[model samples]
Target: MLFRQLEYLVALARERHFARAAQSCGVSQPSLSEAIRKLEEDFGVPLIQRGRRFDGLTAEGERVVVWARQILADRDALRGEVDAMRTGLSGRIRIGTVPSAATAVPRLIDPLCTRHPLLTAQVMADLASTDVLAMLREFSIDAALTYLDDDVRAAFRVVPLYREKYVLLTDAAWAPVRGESVSWAEAAALPLCLLTTAMRGRRTMDAFFAEEGAEPVARVETDSFASLIAHVVPGRWAGIVPLAWIHALGVPPGVRAVPMADTSPAPEIGLVACRREPESVTVQALLAAAREVDLRPLELLPRMRMPGPDRTRGSGQVGP
Candidate 1:
């Protein structure tokens, strides 16, 4: 019933324990446990299974946890709206972006941070589309930079931001590509290092490969997109990557991003947020900012180079 109690429930769902969840919420274990009990009493059903240690949530508890997230997100939105009315706009915003967007992040985050000095900004690197949805659902993330198919993500708020197509980045040896497009069977024959099967991007590639009834070889397999860019240089190896990343990440000098013809593989990447609730200022700013970027296909330019400053290896691995 109470939002704070719902917060406790969400926290418990995340941490799966009272003491840890309470610590995260900055409350004592008993107080937090009591809140959960009260919520169960209010609902007339046990939310959590109790034992010497925290077992798990009941079926009712699992359902309530989803409601709790939605309710909490609504509360935060309401608070943000009221606060915005009073003050010029000050609130923390959490964002989850795909690894392919690494180069675009600084361009986005720097301007936002500059515009709102009082606001806190947290940027997380996310690689999986499912994880992106989960974070948005749990209110752990305000918005995610990803693309979703209707079946995969029909419930959330989606804004079409950019449609990034895949490009084959190869070392200089293969330049002035033979055809207007390349096929998966042909692509498979070329020496290529690709992202592991874990990444959605990789899976997307695999699907394309499957369509051609061919599988590409990965002499070098990495979870890092940057590593994919790094490994496929002009002289030796090749990789398949999003064109946006080439410009965003400033591809290595030896690498060349050649658009795969015959196979026009384009995935719609966008800003995904919870349509169920009003967005926070930071989240709103992100949406506004995303609209500002007039992103187009990277290979449109006949000749271009990766210009952005290279970034340090991200501390977090791409989560599925």
Candidate 2:
């Protein structure tokens, strides 16, 4: 019946307990129950299953919860738009990023912050690409920094930012005896610490190795890029990282990095936001900033588009 009543119902569904739901809504249990009862009466549907205890929502209630989430999101977006119109863009834009794509956040955020001084950002790193998409879909994050591929382009609108080239980060003692660049096979032979296979970045690396007919095992597998750096810094192991990371975080004193001359095409990493007809102000601001971001620094150069045919292994070049 009322927005607050809808809020109460949503809380009840999320917490799945009357007492906890009331606590979450900062209302007494009786007040929460009364609100839900009124909501059900107004809709002429028994939203909640009645019993001795708080049972789950009814079938219709489940659908209501789904609608409630979207309704609340749209309502919040409307409020954000009004606030932006009144006092410029000013809100914390939550940006989720795949661990390997973390460096791309600052590049997108800085321009927005400069243009809209009131705008602030929070970056959650070490998220897998799947997690990034999940958070975006749930409205948990305003945007995400991830690889823009066919799998995601259909769900989220993408603004191409950079083409991430691979690099082998190793301690000086562990680097190859040959030249500056490291090949997939040579880097694979080292005592390696790499991102967990669950991450798309690690999967891409795995695909590269598989294509080269090599099976390289990592000494350590972690979700955090910091962990990889920590291992490499102490001479414990080596890892593969993007050139953006080396530039953004810089290689620590004990670590050295060389570009991996993998002949396979590089993946294009970019900003992805939900494809809403009327995007929230924060999302709009981020999209605008992404459009203006300078990809030259990352050396994406022309910034290739996604979902093209995989480059053929011309000349059968699998290694450096």
Candidate 3:
């Protein structure tokens, strides 16, 4: 069957309507319908459940849609490989990441883009650890930056970035902690604005607190670090954030990112990508750039000071 027929099937599965799917594909409804019919005839199975209106895909259709997505993705990767060979790697590399690791995307992109002037990078953020795996399977993202958990390490090719260290970001008025660290229990007692449970960072924090025989009840829950910082900057609440964030995105006035005393083994954040034979040039460039980065020195640096002009946040490229 033609690739266009598979494209039409995927579009129908996504849009769930004939006219709308046709509109998205920039084709007439009758044309799209005819294409779908032809696809079913070729496959010798009904792809869609028929009625006066669009119902849904049959079991066979659903399976075909899955294969169609994979075929399309592989086709695009093939084209990208050819383009990279003819004219250097020159396509967008979509990088999905956990919220906490969002700030570090530039460190990876700077070197890659510098090497390939034609390359562009898109960073998606605030994704759960589970979602990162799902997006990779669906080819929704080229790579993911997240904690290097066992399942991820086992399934994909990974590049270790750095171990994430936790710190309690609090207002000076509430807890004046400078050049000193605080224990988890003490921080838990203070009014807090925390990342929502959906965030992997929040889950880590919760596990730490649970071990201390206490549960953290946040006064405010948000998935965005910017939102957490906004609440903490007002001098009434605190947030538990990664030290990587403090170094990458400086804290605002009245907020101090004090190191937590708990010295358990922290999770390592890394880049995860699909393990394909003859990997795409875009992914290869990213791996090469990752090897060049030295996060060891940054990890050894002292806690970040209050925000300043030189300590500006990232370019706001991180997704929600």
Candidate 4:
């Protein structure tokens, strides 16, 4: 059967009405009916159950519907692959990022736009590692910049850009002094206003507290990153902030961030994408630019590698 016929069949199966499905496909009722008939003839099966009204599909019809979806999805994917090859990097790429990556996008974008003038990027923010993995699997996003969990390495391709350290934020006059650093246990006991439990950053901090054998008392919890900073104003409360954000926002007046010392106090944040056989040029461009982005003063660094199935390339042992 033709691609259009399969598309019509799938649409009809979804909408369950010939006229509505036809309208959805921008085709007439007669055209859709004729195509369904053609598809049945091609498959030697009565795909749709006929009645005076909109009857449902037969047993074989359901099976054919599954194949139709696969064929249509594959057809579109094939077209995209061919188009990208001929036109350079010109398609859309959806990316998932954490709240902290907002400032870094311009840096990454500056170099990317210089190379691929026709390429377009859609960067989504505030996604956790779990959300990132789900979106990548659903094909909702081409890649994600999120925390790198150990299991993620086994599930998809990951490119670690940097390790973000947690810092103690407080106003200068109200801040505690005489210590080079503080442990998570000491920090937890203080009255603070931090991110709510919904944010993955908070979840990480909770885990750190669990390890340190302390429970924090947070008077105010907010979802917004800006709110986290706002809470730190002049003894109202103290909160945790990523070093990247401090670099981007600069040290706010009356705010001093002390490093967390005496313990390993950082988590690796990185980019992840599906390990496609023939990665789209747009994806390749993003991967290349991500590698080249400056991530110094931070602990971890991007382990640049060419797009392939080799684990060694992405293992941080080598650079592309």
| Whole-model Cα lDDT of every candidate shown, in order | 0.73, 0.78, 0.81, 0.73
Clash count, predicted structure 1? 6
lDDT of 1 at 181: 60
lDDT of 1: 0.73
How badly does each model clash, as a count of residue pairs?
6, 0, 0, 0
Q: What TM-scores do the predictions have?
A: 0.81, 0.83, 0.87, 0.70
Order of candidate numbers by TM-score, starting with the best: 3, 2, 1, 4
lDDT of 3 by residue, 1-320 (tens): 48999999988888899999999999999999999999999999999999998899999998998888888778878888899889988989999998888888888999899999999999888888899988887777889998898988999999999888777777654534544677777778888899888778888888778777767789999988878888877777888877677677665665556677765677889999999876777888899899889775445424443346666333221111
Q: For residues 1-320, what per-residue lDDT tens digits would candidate 4 score against the true structure?
A: 49999899888988999999999999899999999999899989899999996789999998888777766655655666787678866666678887765556666767887887876788888776577777676565777877777888778787778777767776656545336566788888778887888888888788888888989989899887777887786556778777677656555556556666535546777768778766656667788988988775554222334356653232211111
Q: Per-residue lDDT of 68-168 in model 2, one digit per residue for the tens?
A: 77787788888889989999888678899988778768877888899999888888998878888877776767789899898888877999888888777
Model 1 ranges off by over 4 Å = 105-117, 152-154, 174-183, 233-236, 277-282, 297-320
Worst 10 residues of 1 by lDDT: 311-320
Q: What TM-score quantifies how close candidate 3 is to the native fold?
A: 0.87
Residue 113 of model 3 has an lDDT of 95
**lDDT (tens digit, per residue) of candidate 1 on 1-320:** 49889999999999998889999999999999999899888999999999999999999999999888887877777887788778756787888887765545665566666776666778889557778877877889888877667854587766676666767766544654455566777788877788877888888888888888897887878888777777765356777777667566554654445566535446777778876534566678777767776665443423342335654322211111
What RMSD does each model have against the real structure?
5.9, 8.1, 4.6, 10.1
Candidate 4: deviation at residue 29, Å? 14
Residue 217 of model 4: what lDDT? 89
Candidate 4 clash pair list: none
Candidate that would win on lDDT? 3
